[model samples]
Target: MKEYKFLRILDKFEKIYTKIGVDYDKMRLILSMKLTLDSRRTSTIMQDQNKNNNEEDKNIFNRALIIYAIMGIFIGITAMVSFNNMYKFSILFGMFMFLVLTIFISDFSNVLLDIRDKNIIGTKGIDNKTINAAKITHICYYIFLTSLALSWLAIIGSFRQSPLVGIIFILELIVIDVFMIVLTALLYLLVLRVFDGEKVKDIINFAQIALVIIMTISYQFLGRMFDIVDLNIIYKSKIWNLFFPPMWFAAPIYAIEGGHINQIIIALIVLAIIVPIIAIILYIKNTSKFENSLSKLNIAKDNEKEKKRGLFYKIGRNLCFNNEEKAVYDLSTSIIKKEREFKLMTYPSLGFVVIFPLLFILIFSVDSFSEIKNISLHMSLNIYWFIFMVPTILMALQYSKDYKAAWIYQSTFVNDKRNIYKGAYKAVISNLLLPLYLLESIMFIVIFGMKVIPILIIGFIFMLIFIVIQHIISKNKLPFTLKMGEIDKGQNIISTLLGMVILGVAVGVNYFILINTYLLIIYGVILTIITFIMWKKCILDFSTN
Candidate 1:
C-alpha cells in the first residue's frame, strides 16, 4: 500500500489511542488521515509551496496552534483568579470545560460533520459504527490537545490546594471531557439524521454561528453574575447548579471535598455514567442507519420549498442605494448570506457587537433606579462602537476562497465602478450594520425610554459618515475578489484603529454636545448632507480600471 501523506499524523495518534480500543483507533486513524489530506488539498498550502519551501509554512502553522493553546491557558488562569479561591476544584474544572465546550460548539462542530468526510469515508466498506466512532475519537484527539494546553495551569493549582482534590480533579476532567465529546458527537448525528444531509451542512454552519452568539452572551452574563456574588453561592444553589453543565462535574468535586454525598451528588454521578453509556448505545445501534442516511443525504428532496423574500429586500433597498447599483447590491448580499468563509471571518465581529453593549450595561449601571436609567445612556453611546463592523465587513468583503471566480467582474462590461462600491456599501450597511444598529436601538429605547431615539439617530448619522469615508478608502477592492491571505493585514489594522478612534470622537460629541432635540436634528441634517456628499465623492473617486 502507498503511504498516505497524512499517514504520519494518524500513526502518531494511533499509537496513543490504540490502547483505548483497537477497532475504534484504527477507524479514527483512517478518518484522520482522510480528513487531513482533504483539508491540505483544499487549503492549497503545500500545492502552492513545494516540499522545499513548505517547511516554513508548516512551522508557522504549528507556531500559531501553540499560540492559540497558550491563549487558552491564560483564560483558565483568568477564570481561576476570578473565583477568589472559593470552590477551587469546581471553578478550575468548570473553567476548563467552559473553554473546551465553547471551542467544540463554535469551532469544531463543522469539522465533526464535514460532509467531505462523510462522502469519502462512507463509500468504503467501513461500517457506520466504526465511522461514527472514528469521528468522535478524532474530535477527542483535538479536545485532548486543547485540554493539555488548557488544564496544566488549573491542574497545578489543584495540586497546590490538596493532593486528593488534585487527583479527583484529573479523574473528573477525563470523565467530563469524554462525556462532552460523546454528547456533542451524538448531537451531530441526531442533527444529520433529522435534517436533510445536504441541508445538514448549512444547518451546521448556522448552528455554529448561533452557538457563538449564545456563548458570547452567556460568558458576559455569567461574568456579571460571578462578580455580584461569591463562587460558593453559585455552587451551593441547587436551582442554579441544575441549569449549569459545569456544576454537574463540580458536584463530585464538591462531594469529595467535604460536601454532603446527597441526592445531588448521586444524581450527578448517575448522569455522568448514564449519559455517555446511552450516547454510545444509541450511536452503535443506529450506525447502519446513520451510514445509509449519509449516502442518501445528497439526494434532492422535492418537498423543499423556496424561501419568501425578506425585509432586507423591501426596506434596506430604499434606504441605501439606487436601481443602477442593484447588481452589486445583490452580488454582495448573496456572498454574505451564502459564503461560509465570509461568515467565519465576519461572525466574530457580530458576536462582539452584541456582547459589548450588554457588557457596558453590566459594568456601568448602578443599583439605583435613576442610575439604572443611565444604563441606556451608556448603551446608546457604546452602540456607536458597531460603526467599526462596517469597516470590518468591507475588509472581509474583499476576500474569498473562490476569489478567482471573481474574474467575471473584469470580463463583463461595467458602466461605472461606483455602482459596485455603492451596492457593496449598502449590503454591508443593510445586511450587517443596519440590523445590529436596530437591535441596539430597540434595546436602548426600551431601557432608556424614547429620549434615546435622538442619540441613536445622531450616532447612526455619524456612523454613516464614518463607514462612507472608510469605504472610499477601501472601495478599490471588489467584493470576494481577493484571496483572504492576499489582503494587506497592516492596512486593515490601521483602518480598524482609525475607525475606533473616529467612532469614539463621534460618540463623545453626540453624548455631550448634541444632547438637545434641536441640536440633534440640526446635527443630523448636517451629518446626513455630509454623508451624501461623501457617498457621491466615494463612488466617483474609485475606479476598477
Candidate 2:
C-alpha cells in the first residue's frame, strides 16, 4: 500500500511539471518553469482575493440599494396616484423625477470619467490611452446638438395634427436653432479661449458659469417676447424672419396679443441698441488689457506663494516666542483657506433653487394677500430647513474631498498634536460651514422678508448648533475620505435621523417658551448664546490639538 501511494504522488508531480511546460529531465529548467507558474498563480489568487473583498463591501452596504429601491417605488406610486386625479402634479412630478435621474446619472458618469482620466495620466501603452481634448470637445458638441434636435422634434411632434401649427413650430425651431448656434459659437470663443490661461486646462468650468447667467437672462426676455408676437405672421414673414429670427419676431406677436406689445417692443429696441454697444465695449476693454492682466495675475500668484513661504519661516522662528493660542489660531486660518479653496467652487445647487421657486409661484398663482402670506410662511420655513440641510451635506462632501486629497500634509508642520486637530476643526467650520450659513441667511431674508427676521435669527442659531454637532460626530465617529457617491447616501441616513431629533426638541422648546414675537426674540438670544459658547469651545479644542 505504501509503494502504491508513493507511485501515485510521483505520477501527479510528473503531470503537473509537464502541464506547466517543464522538462523533467532538465532539473534547472523544470525549477524555473515551476517558479514562473507559481508566481502567475499567486497573482491570480491575489486578484480573486481583492474581488472577494470588494464584493464583501458591496454586501455590507446592501441597505443603501434597498433604500434607493424603496424611494423609487414610493415616488412611482405617488406619481401614478396624481395622474389618476388628472392633476398637473403628476406631470410636474414626472418632470422632477426625470430631471433628478438625468442629473445624477450625468454627474456620476462625469465622476467615473474623471477617475479614468486620472488613471490614464502618464500611461504610454495604447491600451491605456487617455481621452484627448479634441475628443472631449467633440462629445460635448454632439451632446448639445442632440439635445437641441430632440427638443425641436418633440415640439414639432406635438403639433402634427395642425399644418398651421406645424408650420409655426418649424419656423420657431429654425429661429431658435439659428440664435442658439450663434450664441453657442460666441460663448465658446469668449469663454473657452478668451478666459483660458496657461494654468486653466478645463475651459468648461468658466464657460458653465457664463452659460448659466446668459441663459437665465435670455430665457426671461424670450418669455416676455413670446407673449407679444403673432406666431402665424412671424412664421409667414420672410423679411421678419431674416432680420429678427423667428423667436424674436414671434415674441413681439405673442406679447401684442397678451397686451404687453408696447412693453415688449420697448424692451427689444433697448436690447438691440444696448447689446451691441456693451459687446463692443467688453471686446475693446478685454482686448486692450487681456495680456497685461494675465501677466499681472501670474505675478501676483507668485508673490502670494512667496508670502506664504515667508510667513511659514517667520512662524517657525517665532515658534517659542508666541503663545500656543495665537499660533493655533493662525494655523487654523491657513488650513481653512487651504481646505475650502476660498469658496472658488463652493456654491449651493443654484439651479434647483431658481427653477423650483419660479415653478411654484407660477403654478400656484397666489394672487390674494392672505394666500401669499401663507405661502411666504410655509416656503420660508421649508427653505430655511432645506438651506440648513443642503449646506451641511455639501460641507460634509467638501470635507471628504479634502481628506481624500491627503491635505493632512499641512498638519505635519504643527509640532503640537492638539493644534493639528484644532486646525482641522477650524478649517472645516471657517471654510466650508460659515460660507454656507451666510448664504442661507441671505437667501432666507430675500425670500421671506423682514417679518420673519426673528425666526430667521433663531433658525440661523439652531443651524450653527446643528453644524457643530454634525462636525463633532463626523470627526470622531465617521471615517474621513469617503467616496463622493457614498457620502450623499450616508449623509441622508444620518442627517434624517439626527435632524428630526433636533427639530423635535426645538419645537418643544419653542412651545414651552411661548410661540409669539417674544418667543422669537428669546429663542434668538438663547441660540446666540449657545452658538457663542460652542464656537469658543470648538476654537479652544482646536487650539489644544
Candidate 3:
C-alpha cells in the first residue's frame, strides 16, 4: 500500500511524541491500518464509493476533500461579499460551523465510538497513551483535512484584507474545531460516567438523534435571521442572538474592523477563547474516562426486553395480508426501530419534509391569520409534496451497512416472493411515512380547516400507490440487500425530482377534479383500487435478493 503523506510528515515529530510517552511507531501503525480500512468504505456526505473496486477509486477520501474545497469557494465569496462585517461573517461562520459540526457528527462519530480497537488492541500490551493517541489522531486527521479543504479560500480572502486578520482567522478556526470536538466528547463521557449499563448506551444513541433534529431546525432559522432587500443585507442583533454560537465567533472580526470594542465583544472573545481552553483541559484530564466510555458500546443488550417491540410486530400484523408479508414487515420495522445509522440518515429528510414547506407557508404563503383560511387551494396542492420523500426514503430503505445479513431472506422458503416487498413497502409506509403524513395532515387541517381532510386522505392514498409503482417499476432492490457504498447522492436528487414530477401530474389532474366534489370522490376511489392492484403484484412478483 502507498504511504500517506501525512504519515511521512509525522515521522519528523517522532522524537517529540516518544518523549511525551506515546508509542509513536505503534500509534502510526494503528492509524495507517484505519486509513486503509476506511479507504474501502465510502463517505456518507461527499462521494460514492466505486463498487467496481477500481484502482483509481481508492483515493475516495482525497476526492472528498476536493468537494470540500469546492464548497470553500462559497465561504470565500461570503467573506468578501459587500456587506457589514458582522452580518456577513455571522452568515459565513454560520455556514462554516454548521458544516464542521454536522460532518463531525455524522462521519467521525463512527470512528470515535468504535470499540473494536479497544477490544482488540488494548489486550496486546499497547499502553493507554498510545491507544488514545492513535484514536485522537484518527479524528484529528479527518478534521484537519476537512478544514484544509474548507478554509483555504477564506484564509486567502482574509489575507488580502490584512495579514493579521488572516492569522487571527486561522487561530480562531483551530480553537472552534477544538472546542466542538472536546465539548462533544465531554458530553458523552459525562453521560457514561453518570449512568449505568443500557441506559447510558441508549442515551448516547438518542443524543445523536437529538443533535440531528436541533441542527436541522437551526438550519431553517439561518435564512430567517437576516433581512435582504434588493441585494443589500441587514442584520440587527437581539438578545436572543446570544443563543447562537456563530454570532459569538463572528463578533471579534466585527469589533476589530470597526475599531472599537464593547463589553459584548469582549465577552464573546473571552468565550471564544476561554471556553475551548477549559474544555480542552477537562477533556485531557478525562482521557481515560473517555476511553472507558467508548467501551460501553460493546455491552450486549438484553434481548428479552425487546417484547416492548410488540408494537412493531402489531403494526406488521395489521398492515400485511399474509404470513410471508407479515414476517418481512416485522423484519423491516425492527431494523428501522433499532438502527441508529438509519435514523441519522433519514431524519434530516424527515425533518425537511415538514420544515421546508411549513417555513415556506409561514414566510410566503399567508400574510395574516385571515389569509390562512383562503389557502384551501394552496393546501390541496401542497398535500402532494409529501411524495417528495418517497424516493429518498425508499432509496435509504434499500441500502444497509449490514447488507450481508440479508442472506437470511434468500435462505428462507417463500411461496409468494412478491409478498416480501409488499410487506417491506407496507412497513416503511406504516413506520415512517404514515405518521409523517398524518402529522402534517393535522397541522394543515388546523390551518386550512376540516375542509382539507378529504384532500389529505386522497393525497395520502395516492402516495402509497405512486410510491409502490415508482419503486417496483424503476429499480426494485430487495430491502436492505444493497451495500450503501453503491449509493450516489446525485442519484437520490434525481429520483426525488422525478417523484415530484410524477406527483405534480396528479396534482394538476386533481385541480380540475377539485372543481367538482363528486369528481374528487371518484378520483379517490380509483386510487384506492389502484393501491389494491399494486398490492397484488410488485412488478412481476419480486423476491428478497
Candidate 4:
C-alpha cells in the first residue's frame, strides 16, 4: 500500500503488464519492497562526498539528481551544438547511450545481480518470471529517472524542431531506452555464462572501470566519424555503419529533418523500432534462466580459483623492502582484491593506470594507428586521470569492514610503523600497477613509435612520486585501520579536490618541457632523484605517525 509515486502510476498499466504475462500484483509488491529498502541508500557514484562520516541518516538522492543534472548539461550542450544533424545526433545518442550504460554498470549491478528474491519470493511459490519482472522493473525505475534528468534538456531542445518532432523524439527515446536496458541485460548474461559468482563480480567491476575510460576517451574520436568537406561537416550514410546502434536511433531524426527517406534510412528506422521488440521478447524468454543463475552467487567458491597464488603475491615477495613489509603487502593485496565493499567504494588509480592507455588506444588510434601522430603527445593526458584519482582511491587502503583485525597492525613487533605502510604501498605498486604501467609503456612505444618514450617514462615516475606523496599526506593509520562506515567523506572530498590542483601543476610542468628532449631529460632526472629521496625518508616520516 506504501507505493512510491512511480509505482502508483505503474498501477494504471496493470492491464498492459498482465498482457505480457507478468503477475501485476506480485511484481508491484516486490518492487515496492525493494525500492523502499534502496531509497535509503546513497548513490555509489556520488556517495554524498560532503557528508560527515559519522552523520546520521539522511537522503542524498536529491544530491544525486543534482549530479545527474550537471552531467546532463554536457549532453544538452552536445545536442545544441551545430553540426550535421545526423552526426550531431549520433554524438548525442552515443554519449547518451554510453552515459546510461556506464551509470547502469556502476550503480545497477546490485539489482541485476541480487539473489534475495529467488530465496524469499520463490519459496512463496511465485515463479522466476514475476521475480525477474520485479528486478527489471527496479532497475528501470531508477534508470528512467536518471535518463530523464539527462534527457530533459535534449528533449526540450527538440521542440524547436516542432512539437510533433518533439513528441516523435519522446517516442523514439522510449523505444531506445528499452533497447539499451536489454542490450545491457544481454551483456550481463554473456558475463554470467563465463564466470561463476566471484569471477562474474570481478568482471562487472572491471567493466565499470573499462566503460568509464571508454566514455571519456571516445569523445576524442567523435569528430573522426564526420567527414568535413569544403568547410562543411557533412555526414554520408554508409550501409556498413548501420551496424552501430546510435546510427539506428539517429536515422529517424535524420529522415524527419529535411531529408528524403531512402531504403537505408527506412531500414535503420525500422531496426530501431523492431530490434528492441525482439530483444524484449528474447529477454522475457530468458527471464527464468537468468533468475535461476542467481543460485551461483550463493554457491561455494571455485576450488581451482582458491588454489592459485596471485601474481601480486609473487611480485610483492621480491619487490617489498623486508619480510614484515612483504607480509603486509600480501595481506593488503588479499584484502583489496577480496573485499566487495572496498571495490565498490574505492577508487584505485591503479585500475586507471592499467585501463587508461589501452582505452585511449582503443578509442583515438584504433582506426588510424599510424596517422594519429598528433595524439602521441596528447596521450600524456592519460596520466592526468590516474594522478587526480590516486588520493581518493589510495585512501581506501586505510579503511575496511573488518577493521577489528587492524589490531594485528599493532600486534606486530617492529621498530618502525613505516614498514607497515610501505609494505602495503609496495604491494599496490608491484602486484599490479608497476608492471602494467611498464607493459603499457612498451605498447605505447610500439604503436606511437619511440617519440612517446619520454612521456611514458615521466608518467611512470610521476605515478610513483604522486602516490608516495598522497599516501604520506593522507591519514597515517595502518592498512584497514578504520571501519568503512567511518570514512572521512568530507575530508576525503576536500583532499581529492586539492589533489586535482596539485596534479594539474604536475601535468603543466611535465607538458612544459615534454617537446624539448633536453628539458624532458632534465625533468625526468630531477623527478627520479626526488622519487628516490621521497620513497626513502620523507614518505615514511608522516605516513607512520
Best by lDDT: 3
Model 2 residue 529 distance off true place after TM-score fit, in angstroms: 1.9
Ordering by TM-score: 4, 3, 1, 2
Error of 1 at 17 (Å): 9.5
Regions of model 2 farther than 4 Å from truth: 1-190, 197-379, 390-448, 474-492, 504-515, 537-545
Q: Model 1, range 30-118, lDDT digits (tens) per residue?
A: 76575554333322211122233323223233433475567667755643453433244445655666567666764555565555655
> Which residue pairs collide in model 3, if any?
none
After superposition, the stretches of candidate 1 with alpha carbons farther than 4 Å from their true spots are: 1-29, 35-60, 76-98, 171-203, 220-235, 259-308, 319-324, 348-352, 366-376, 472-476, 484-488, 539-545
Per-prediction TM-score to the true structure, in the order listed = 0.80, 0.46, 0.84, 0.86
Q: Candidates' lDDT values, in order?
A: 0.63, 0.39, 0.73, 0.72
Give the distance in Å from residue 387's predicted Cα in candidate 2 to where it truly belongs: 4.7
So what's the TM-score on candidate 4?
0.86
Question: In terms of TM-score, which candidate is stronger, 1 or 4?
Answer: 4
TM-score preference between candidates 1 and 3, better one: 3
Model 4 lDDT, residue 187, Cα: 64
The better-scoring model by TM-score among 2 and 4 is 4
